[model samples]
Target: MTNPTNLTPSAFTGARRVATALAIGVLTGLAQAGALEVLVLDKEGKPVPDAVVIVVPSGLGVAKNPPPMAAVVNQEKMQFLPPVSVVALGAKVRFSNNDAWDHHVRLTAPGTAVSANPASAEGMSLRLEGKTAGKPAYSAVLTMDKPGATGAVLLGCFIHGSMSGHVYVADSPWTVKTEANGIAVLEDVPEGSATAKVWHAAQVVDKTPQTLVVGSTPAKLTLQLDVVPKRRRG
Candidate 1:
């Protein structure tokens, strides 16, 4: 009985509001019984942490939004908000700096590394021009033109070497980033064997497909992902 779109935060921008509205409509239409709730679990069975879970319907029932003119990745406190991002193919992303200093944004071609790769080719890099405190956020737009493309783009600040984030590009709009509670909900899944993929940084914990069956009543599903500690190298 919870309104999915109602969960949006007050800080949501115009585009986010639009996206949330569309997502709610799509989810409402796909509500049904017999839905499978999946848990993306590690080998130990605890909830996998910080993983993005995406549900792609087998049928062509999902609506597609026209690629937006631009997309934005905000910079604040020498860090990227939403450290992990997933956007549709051909969409553009704008890098916005909220901090007083400048930020250098970079990206990698989709599907380059498994997130743990030591060396990966840099996709592209750009700097965000600074803005006054009261001015609207300044953004650098990056377009994703290639279809069937997926990858994690690393973002960093020139002033802060330790700052980094990931930009995940997918072919569809079913992508959902995990929350602090470690839950990524994909609503309006069609009735059939649909595949839901979960990715953390560059590591793919759940590439295996999950089956979703839709009916007349609302369906609930749960997925679990494992968070493995990064191995240190000399």
Candidate 2:
């Protein structure tokens, strides 16, 4: 992934699109361009059924209709609106606080991962922007140059220590959150044979990586993870 830790918004976006597109194209070529099987689990070998899993081709391919303009993460009840988030490497992440109280949101500890570019952090903050419902939202955009998983982005408020959530940046559209049954299927992976990786926010980093090959018909990959609690409303 290309890292734009120091570039301005316009420069960063242009650089990111080119880098991500090229990488996706390469991987798409190497891959049969078929469906992929994804499995999620915890450190204890139990099924992590509800986590989000995504697969970005190690290289670039034909870009899908660019996704919607931007996605959002909200702050409500002193917690992040959604505990889990997924985005393409060059997409925008908007942060909006809908709670009755004010919260300070910042990315104190950026994630670390190997990227095609070595001069900048693959992950960075556009800025510490804030938002409120009934008002305009605040946002920042980050780009990743390589296709791989990352640690976690730590979001916190000096006013509310418990407010937190995870942001996942993927290189491909092959990403999905698992159902309650602990299964997530990545449709249209390169057919034939390839390796697939599973990730979760509630467990150790990439604790369970599975490999599978797609055939003429769709493929089914089943996985398990240790049990964990989903987000609940108070």
Candidate 3:
């Protein structure tokens, strides 16, 4: 369920992205790739599910796709499956009501795009001047004004107040949602050093980037997070 407070559009005001597609492609094509295993735990060291983990190389750029990576959120039995979704910025999302009755999906969040043109990928410039700085790109939400779009929106059934779900729009291609076991595996990482980031709807921070190094063998990382859940709304 999505709490009405704590997470709003104004959050991610300091976030930015650039040349995201090329960066993901290059990282995908790395010759010597390794796996990055992530373990997420709460401040109490309890497993936290649905947390997002993203890795950005030290000298690469980040960008979001137009449709938010074709992510889908389904409503069945008056509940949302995969309760939380993670998508890249500018990605497109789909909402479906599988319940017998009708349900309305709404997403409320502040969204902005730094790309020269939100719709034109060619028009999207990194301002990198052909430099691979490997700086971590920040993320902000994007409104779903078009059909089948999803970003930072509060999805709910106007009729069923108990129904709630959320979608996260991120900037990096290396992002994944933590499973129930608090585990996430990032594969094909080039053997080198990179920056690791954790993002969730409940927790916000000024800066908390960790260093990750991928080598011939797989690496394991345990991340501690606070379970500051927002109160349920009526």
Q: Which candidate's TM-score is highest?
A: 1
CA RMSD per model (angstroms) = 13.1, 13.7, 21.0
lDDT of each: 0.59, 0.57, 0.58
Clashes of 2: 29
Model 3 worst lDDT run, 10 consecutive residues: 123-132
Per-residue C-alpha lDDT of model 1 across residues 1-234, encoded as one tens digit per residue: 977677657645766888988888686563332333344454455455446666666654553332233566788877777676666666677778888777777665444532212243445566777768789877866666554455555666666786777766665556666554556555544556667666665355435556666554545566544455332121
- Name the regions of candidate 3 deviating beyond 4 angstroms: 1-31, 59-68, 110-153, 204-207, 228-234
Q: Poorest 10 consecutive residues of model 2 by lDDT?
A: 60-69
Candidate 2 lDDT by residue in tens digits, 133-168: 577655444443334533345556767777667666
lDDT of 3 by residue, 1-234 (tens): 877565565553323223465566676553466778888777677777777787775533332221145666666667766578876555556565555455655444433222223363221211111112353222223333333332334455556788777666655567778887888787766667888877665665422878978788998888777665543332
After aligning candidate 1 to the native by TM-score, how far in Å is the CA of 184 from where it should be? 2.4
How does candidate 3 score on lDDT? 0.58
Q: Tell me model 1's lDDT, rounded to 2 decimals.
A: 0.59
